[model samples]
Target: MSQLMSIDTFLDSEEVLVDVRTPSEFLKAHIPKALNIPLLTDQERAEVGTLYRHKGKEKAVLKGLDLVGPKMSDIVRSFLEVAPKRTVRLYCWRGGQRSQSVAWLLEQAGFKAKILKDGYKSFRRWVLNHFEREYQFRVLGGYTGVGKSDLLQILENKGAQVLDLEKEAHHRGSAFGGIGLPKQPSTQHYENKLAMRLRAFDMRLPIWLEDESRLVGKCAVPEFLFQQISRAQLFVVCRTIEERIVRLCQLYGVEQKQSLIDACMRIKKRLGLEHTKKAISLIEAGLLDEATLIILKYYDKKYQYSIDKRVVSLYLNGSEMSDVQLAERLLNR
Candidate 1:
């Protein structure tokens, strides 16, 4: 049997990753390019945790064994179905009991299975470390509704290097951002897509990307890319509130009036019910300008607050430049 390998080693190999974490945990987040094949159901894991805390370790282990014993054949079959024919690497939360058990089973069945040394935890740590390190990046920061995506498209059209993070994640990255958008890709798919894009870029020139959170919809940015964005120089696009609202309306389409209202309602607690009510009334009255003013004051402030927290160095408000000039400057910079 081959010795267990560290996540970094496993990452470099041409092997398929078998993630044995709970589905919910996998859904919330996971290592980039990892495929999930949970050894325990969400409820089963919860039951085991409760038993461990309230009962005892022995009792929890016994219960876990009881649950897994009957399902062993089914689990093995399921894993084989998705696993590649070549080398296979397996991991759970830690490289402790679950992954070891699975790897042992595979080895006994005459299949080569390499266990991850520190499991998913180690891979997550690696990701965080890589992200915290410095990397060169060019950020696209713009006020809400400034058509940053359009600008990205224009840049791409002009043959400039770009990474459309939102497009890769299949999310627009806002509260009402998901409306009219396709279902977001899995984190694994997001990383695969992003990797391809990164490979396509000329390493000599800096990469350009929009400012985004670590998680976009259901997908997560890979650790290295996330870190790169965090340290990268920023360029802000500024536009008038009215102009922004017009751009947003165009992006979302006028048919999303209800989505807009529902989004406003969801934030009622933060914006205050009175303010939300006024915003809703403006929308209902077909006074888009009035509704936009309220939303801009409220939502725009939130956007600015997030920007303040991130604190990237270079800032350019798009309100001052024409779109063509902005595109040229972004490409040249």
Candidate 2:
């Protein structure tokens, strides 16, 4: 028989985490490092769920068996191919039938597969609760195009514990944030990734993170983490508007003319229709610098409004130093 492993034991072990949930479920959110080897396909799970609703428990079980039984030997063989040492850690959505069945089949095939207690939901709970703990946070705050993200990366290169949340969310936290990035993960999955990243750091040392509003594209920062960010030590980088506009154009100076116009259109209500029209026209005319100025007028004002709400602990004239120099100065102090 396969062994039943507690979440802690499974975590402490060296075995690979194999998720047995459907591909759709695994794609939405999953425990980090989990290799998905679904016991049932997406359609099969839906069919089984529909069967359970009206055909009674026994009928549902039989239907699930009918769907999965054909793939049993192939599944076991594929898992062994991933874990050649005959050891594996398995889980499903709620740690019920799917993982248990897979564990049994794997054990029958001479593999010592262990099922995670309470499955992925347990890990989700653990991560959600992880945000409640206190950690020393040093926030790098600045207006748009102030190069805060670049400085954060510099700090990381210099051995500082930095949490690049934009990197995590694949966004720069603006109307144009998602332009060049892949689709954002759901907020739940973002929290899961954030929690996993936090676990690697020593909380005693101040974690350097870029100041972010709660929403990054579609992903929202967890409430506890957001509260921490709101109250953390702030390092505001002060740079000139002209300099910031130069940097913004450098960061977003892409050849995708339509994309740039569409991104600007997203904030048309806030930017005003006249301003938006002018910006789009400038972009169409190959005048990115002029278009950049128009957009920055709106973004800068909006960012200033947000900054006005926060207490600035310190403001550093970032124009005086390179990003690496700024990073070193901030960390050394």
Q: What is the C-alpha RMSD of each candidate to the true structure, in Å?
A: 5.5, 1.5
Deviation in Å, model 1, residue 127 alpha carbon: 2.0
Question: 1-333, model 2: which lDDT tens digit per residue?
Answer: 777777667777788889999999989988878888999999999999998998888999999899988889889888988999989989998889999999888888888878888888888888888899998999999888899999988899989999889998989999999988889988888888999899889988989999888899899999889999999889999899889988988877864889899999999999999999999999999888899888888887887888888898889998898888888889888
User: Candidate 1, which segments miss by more than 4 Å at Cα?
Assistant: 46-65, 84-86, 153-205, 211-232, 238-243, 254-256, 266-278, 285-290, 297-325
- How much lDDT does each candidate structure score? 0.76, 0.88
Q: Which ten residues in a row have the lowest lDDT in candidate 1?
A: 127-136
TM-scores, each model vs. reference: 0.70, 0.95
Best by TM-score: 2
